[model samples]
Each structure stands twice: as structure tokens, then as C-alpha cells.
Target: MRALSVYRDTTGSKLVLDDVPEPDLADGDLLVEALALGVCGTDREIVARGPIWGTERPDRLILGHESLGRVLEAPNGAEISPGDLVVGIVRRPDPVPCGYCAVGQFDLCENGQYTERGILGRDGFGSERFRLEQDYAVRVDPALGLAGVLLEPASVVAKAWEQLDHVVRRTRRRALVLGAGPIGLLAALLGVQRGLEVHVVDQVEHGAKPRQTRDLGAVYHSFMEDLSGTFDAVVECSGVLVGEAIARTAPGGAACLVGIGAPHGAGTVNLGELNLDLVTQNKLVMGTINSNRSHFEAAHQALRQIDRRWLEGLLTDRLPLSAWRSAFDTSPERIKAVIEFDA
Candidate 1:
């Protein structure tokens, strides 16, 4: 099987299109044929900096986390069946299985010992075929087709909204989503689905980001300064503007920070003023990443209810496995890039 992998050693690291052996399934694992894999910043970072978490042989790590596949074989009595579409859950609980992990809330792993597929410690679904434990594979609606590839990222948005619901006590009428990437757009879509007025901000003023935002019946802005009035809910998908996004939330509203921004060497924030605003307004700000099964299931439901055409629009680029290098291009016009495998 041909797999996209990252090879690292004491000398250095590099991306490799290695011809590896077929994965051996565990007792309760399902063998799935890869359909499509979503490319994101994390994959690019790993290609550039190498794997940070894995077994002794980090070089063996596969480099994809967002996955979509079709079951080729399943164990008897498993909830999934052969030919069913599925997405693999990324995080696995620690060996100790902390209090949160013990209850299946491994997304909130307390000990930082969790292993993430194609990420922290395990091989990912970045090949022609991969193995997923029955318990960690979530079925996708066949109706979604290739658009189902969006599920993994949408699950992250689902978890963010889930947390926001717990923090905000009042009715949410308006939402502000910072950044217009896949995560930001999906965040806005969920806000629209919830009947809130959605507004998206991104630096790209004349491209698909703004057009897609408008197509969803949400307003789009080129700069945060152009957005007027505070929102009951704020989703900061641009890691660079956490403080600004939080400041734009209305009294009693909450902000969910989703993006992991790059470090600004000498840049500083006025934490004292930010703290005062939060204290005086009774606001809440929180960060969320990865998702549990419940979030994936919720995201599945959300996708089912969305317009297929609109959902498909987010997938601006789809290339064959042979053209995988092109799929990594970060052009403004490209929203979500996918690599399709030969069936």
C-alpha cells in the first residue's frame, strides 16, 4: 500500500510517499479503504518540522488526521457493516485512562498522555487503506458522498458550539466567526443553522471566502473594524485574534477560541484590560480542540441537514493521490483541499 508518511531521525525529517505493508487489524478493528483525506495546516507543519509524538520509530508515522473511508470488512455484530462510509476518530485515551478518559471524554484528557491518530502516537488513514477500531469509527451518511470528508473538521466546530451552549445562558441572536477557513466557515454554518445572524471576517475580501459567507446568508467583512455591534456568540477561528474576538462579545456572551495561532515573538496583549472587560461584563472565553464521539455524531446530523451544494462548495480543490503535492497549496481561492485514493 502507498502511504503518505513523515520520516524522522537524529539527522532530520522529510515527507515520504512510502510503499508500506498493509496494516494488520486488531481483534475488533475494521479494515477501511481510504476514500479521501483532508489536508490542513497540521499536516504541513509535520512535513516541515517532523513528528513530535509517536513510538520509538517516529519515521513510521503516517501524516493525515482528517479522514474519510469505506469499510472493506467488519467483525460480526459490529454496528458498522462492509461498504458503509466512515470517519476515524483521532484521539485515544492514555494508558492510565484519566478520569475524563475513563468516561470516554478523552478529548479532555487530564494527563496529556492521549495518543492522536496521524498526530500524537498512532498511524493515520493517509494510505490506500487503513485500520480503525470499531469503537472509534463513526458512520457517515452515504448521501454526503465526498463531502463527508468535512466531518472530522466539523466535529471540532460541533464541540466548540457544544461548549458555548454551556457557557452562554441567554438566547444567542448573532454570531461573529473570525477567519474564513474551513473551520471558520463551518462554525458560521452552525451558527446559521441555530438561527443566529452570522458574520464572518477574513482578509481575503474578493474570493470564495466572502462569497461563500454571503451565500450562507451571513455577512462578510474584510477587517474586524468593519464589523459593527457585539455578538452574543463569538468563534475565533483565527488564532491571531483571540483577544479581539473576546472583546467583541456582548455582555454575558461567550467566545470560543478554535485556531492554534503561530507565535508572535514580541507581540503583547493587554491582559489587565481584557480581564477587566470579562469581569465587568460577566463573559466567558474558552478554547476547544479535537472531539469526542458525541461531537462527531452531532456533526454528522448537522451535515445531513445542510444543503449539499453549499457544503460541496467548501471543497474547492480535489486532486488524485499522485497530485498530492498540489493539494497542499494554500491559495486564497482554495477552501478545502482533498486527496482522493484509487479504489
Candidate 2:
């Protein structure tokens, strides 16, 4: 099996396409043949900073977490079967089985011992094949085809919106998503599905993002100056807008931070006034990371409801595994890039 491995010594280096042994699957485990894999900002960051969370031996770990595959082998009694399309959940519970992990909410693992496939201690799915426990594999709609690779990222947005639904009380809500990347666009898609008046703000003013936003019947803004009203719920997918998004969150509204930004330098904050708003406006600000199994299922449902043509449009590139280098290359017009294994 050929897999994409990143070198630890050379941070910000390209992935090395090498021949690796095929995954060994247990009887109850699923043997998934990779079909398509989505590459996101986290993938780019790991390639740039070296493997900070996954393996200490940087180059040894595989480098993909968002994936779509077909089951090659499934135990007779298992719910999954051969030929089923699926996406593997990245994180596994820690050994300590913290309260959240004990309840199958490993996404909130407390001990910080969780192993995230491709990103943390475990090897990723940047290969021709990988094996996972049946419980960790979420089935994808066959109709999605290559589009199913978006499911993992979609799960994160689904989980974030699921959490927000609990805190927000407004019937007719308005949402502003801070970035027009995959996460932000998906968040906006979910918002539209929920009947919210959605607005997306990103640096790119006249590209696929703005067109996609309009196609979804949502407004898109490149600068905050063009942004009109405060939103009842703000989902910050780009870390750059945290301050402004937090500032513009409507009174009694909730803001969710989903982007993981780099540390540049320190800046002063008006904690006194921010605290005053927190005290009087009943504002809520929360940060969400990964998603759990249920969220994956929710993501599956969300994908099913969306127009396949729109989901297909988000996949801007589909390079084969041999052309892996081009998969990681950053492009201004690229929306989503995928490494296709078989198709």
C-alpha cells in the first residue's frame, strides 16, 4: 500500500509518497479501501508545524483524517457490510475513560490522552487502505460519491450547531459565519437548512465562495464594513474574526469559535467593558473542536438533505494519490481538494 507520510525534521515540507504495508484488520474491524480524502486547513497546519499532537516520530505517521472509503471486509454480524461507503471518526477515547469519554463523548475527553487518527497519536487515512472498529465508521450516502469526503468536516459544523440550538431561544434566527472556507461554508449551509438568515464573511470577495454563498441564498461579505446588522448567533470559522465577531454578537446571542489560529503576539483587551457586556447582555461565547459518533450520523443526515450538485461544487480538485504533492499546494481559488485513491 502506498501512503502519504510527512517528515518531522523538515517542518513545512511536502508529503513523501511511499510504499507502506497494508493495514492489518482484526476480525471485527472494518477493512476500508480509501476512495476519496478531503484536505483542510488542519492538514496544512500539521504539514507546516510538524506533527505536534500525533506521533513524535513525525515522518512515520500517515497524514489524512477526512476520508471516504468502501468497506472491503465486515464481520458477518456487523452492521456495516462490504461495498458500504463510510468515513472514519478521527478521535478515540483516552485510556483514563474520563467522564465524557465514559459516556461515549470522547470528543470532550478530559485527560487529553485521546488519539486522533492522522492528527494525534494514531496513523491517519492517507493511504490506499486503513482499518477501524465498526463502531467508529459512519456510513455515507452512496449518492454523495466523492462528495462524501466532506462528511467529517461537516460533522464538526453539525455538532457546533447542535450545541448552539440548545442555548439560543430565538425562533427566527440570524447567523454570521466568519470564514468562507469549508467549515464556514458548511456552517452556513447548516444554518440555511435550519431556516436562519445566514451571512458569510471572508477575505475573498469575488470567487467561488461568494458565488456559493449566493447559491445557498445566503449573503456574503468580504469586509466587516459591508456587514450590516449584528447576528443572533455567530459562528466564527476563521480565527481572525474572533474579536470582531465577539464584539458584534447580538445581545443575548451566542458566539461559537471553531477556528484554530496561530499565536502571533499579544494584544491588549478591554476586559472591563467585555465583562460588563457579559454581565448585562447575557451573551454566551463557547469554543467547539471535534465531533462525536452521533454528530457523524447527524452529518450524514445533513449531507443527504443537501443538493448533491452544491456539495460536488465544493470539491475543487481531485488529484490522484501519485500527484499527492499538488493536493497540499495552496491555491487562492481552491475550495476543497481531495486525494482520490480508486476513482
Candidate 3:
């Protein structure tokens, strides 16, 4: 199998051409042929960092989290059959308590975890062919289109909405999606579908800014250089230190931080208007990591049912796997860039 890999601990060292062999599998494993894979930010980050898959997570494992592939072989009792189109999720649940596998969240399981599959795991089948646990594989209808192929990330947005849905049942009605990136836009889409008065906030470009909100169906606002009162709820995906800003959620409102950044680099947030000292406040600040399988499933269905043409603009570029470096180094104006595999 020909795949891209990283040797030594450098993001730029991502290997593009290699004839790695197919992996041996256990009775519970399914071998998949990767057709198209999404290179997320971490795909590049891990390449530059010193954490080897096996050494830190998996010894010399492959890097890739959001990917779509075909099932070449399935073990007996596999949930998937050969030749099925499937999306691979990054997190796997341990049948037992693998620390961090808390109820309502199982992606954090640290023990008995597979050596492969997510971006930072022990093992990843980052090749034309790879092995995966049957349950981790999400089946997708081939008819969903290359756009439908976006179910993996779309499901992530679905998962974020699911979390908000649970909270809306009790409190909070409005949502402020804190970035205009793909995740924020998708989260905005789900918020609109679920009947929330959603507002998407981001820094603007000179001309292309208007179209982003026009397609999103959500009211768009620029971040607080034009400051105002607090929003009812917030979903911060701005990719900066948004945690503190999320802490400023309105009373009885909630804030969801969907963006990840460095440890000490967390952003500054003003709390005076959060009304902590001025009034009785009931705010909920939350954070979400990776999406679960249920999220992946729902995202596929939701995206399929939507018009998705606006998403065409969201996918600013499509590059071949060979030119992975160019795409990684140049991703400022882009929201979501895809790597088109063999036709």
C-alpha cells in the first residue's frame, strides 16, 4: 500500500510516497481501502511535533483522523461488509473503563485503545489500505456524493448541535458561533436546523466575507472591535484563546468551546459584562473534543438532507495527496481543504 507518513518529529517530514505493507489484523478488525481522507489541522501539527504514534501513542503509526474509505475485508460479525463505503472516526470506546471514558463521552478512553485510527493514536491506517475496528467504521451511502463524503466532519458539527440540543431542553435559545471556519459554519447550520437564532462571528476579509453569511442562513457579525452586550449563548471556534470568552456566557445561557489551541496561549476574555459580580448569573461553559460514532451517523444524514451547494465555497481548494505540503502551508483564507484521492 502506498501512503504518506512522517519520520522523525517534524510536521514538515510527512512522508508522501512509501510502499508500506498492509497491516495484520485481529478477528475483530476490518481492513479498509482509504479513498479520500481529510487532512485536519492536527494532521499537520502531529507531523511537526515529536510524538511518534507507537512511542507516544502508536509506534510509527499513520496520521489521519477524518477519512472515507471502502471495505476491502471485514472480519466475521463485522458491522460492515466488504465493498461498503465507510467513514473512520478518531476516537474508540473501551468496553471497559479506560480512564476518561466517562458516560456521555467515551472518546477519551486511554487504555485498551487501538494502536491505530485517529490522528494521535497508536496506529492509523494512513495508506490506500488499512485496518479498523468494525464498530469504528461508519457506513455511508455512496450516493451522498463527494459532498456527502463530508459526513465525517459534518457529523462533528452534528455532535456539537446534539450537545446544545440537550441544553436547550432546559435553558438557552440563542447561539453565537465564534468563528467563520467550517466547524463554525456547520455548527451554525445545525443551530438553524434546530431552530436557534444563531449568530456567526468572525474576523472579515475584504470582499468574500458577505457570501459566507449569505449561504450560512445565520446572521453574521464581526468580533468585538465593535463591542456590544453579551450574547445569550456562545459556541467559540475562533482558534484562539476563546475559553475565557466562553466563560462570559450570559446568565442561564451556555457557551461551547469547539476550538483547540496551545496550553498557555489561551486567549483573554472580559468577564465584567458576564454579570458575575453585578447580578445573579447562571451560565454554563462547556468544551467538546472529538465526535462520537453517533455524531458521525447523524452528520451524514443531516448534510445529505441539506442543499450543501454553499459548502462548495467552504471547500476552497482540492489538492492531490502528492502536494500535501502546499495545502498545509497555505491555509489562511481557506476553511476546509480536501485531498482528492484516486478517482
Descending-lDDT candidate ranking? 1, 2, 3
User: After best superposition, candidate 2 residue 51: deviation in angstroms?
Assistant: 0.8
Q: Taking the tens digit of each residue's C-alpha lDDT, what string does model 3 give over 102-216?
A: 5525654556453336454445546777777776778887766556446766776776677766774455566777777777777887787777777776777433434666666
Q: List the residue pairs that clash in candidate 2.
A: 54-120
lDDT over C-alpha atoms for residue 256 of model 2 = 92
Q: Show where candidate 2 strays beyond 4 Å.
A: 10-14, 26-28, 53-59, 265-268
Error of 3 at 314 (Å): 2.5
As a whole number from 0 to 100, the lDDT of residue 92 in candidate 2 is 91
Q: How far is candidate 2 from the true structure (C-alpha RMSD, Å)?
A: 1.9
Q: In terms of lDDT, which candidate is strongest?
A: 1
Candidate with better lDDT, 1 vs 3: 1
lDDT of 2 by residue, 223-262 (tens): 8899887889999987777778777789889999998776
Q: Residue by residue across 164-221, what tens digits does model 1's lDDT show?
A: 9888878889999998999999999999999999999988879788889999999999
Q: Candidate 1: which stretches are off by over 4 Å?
A: 9-11
- Candidate 2 Cα lDDT to native: 0.86
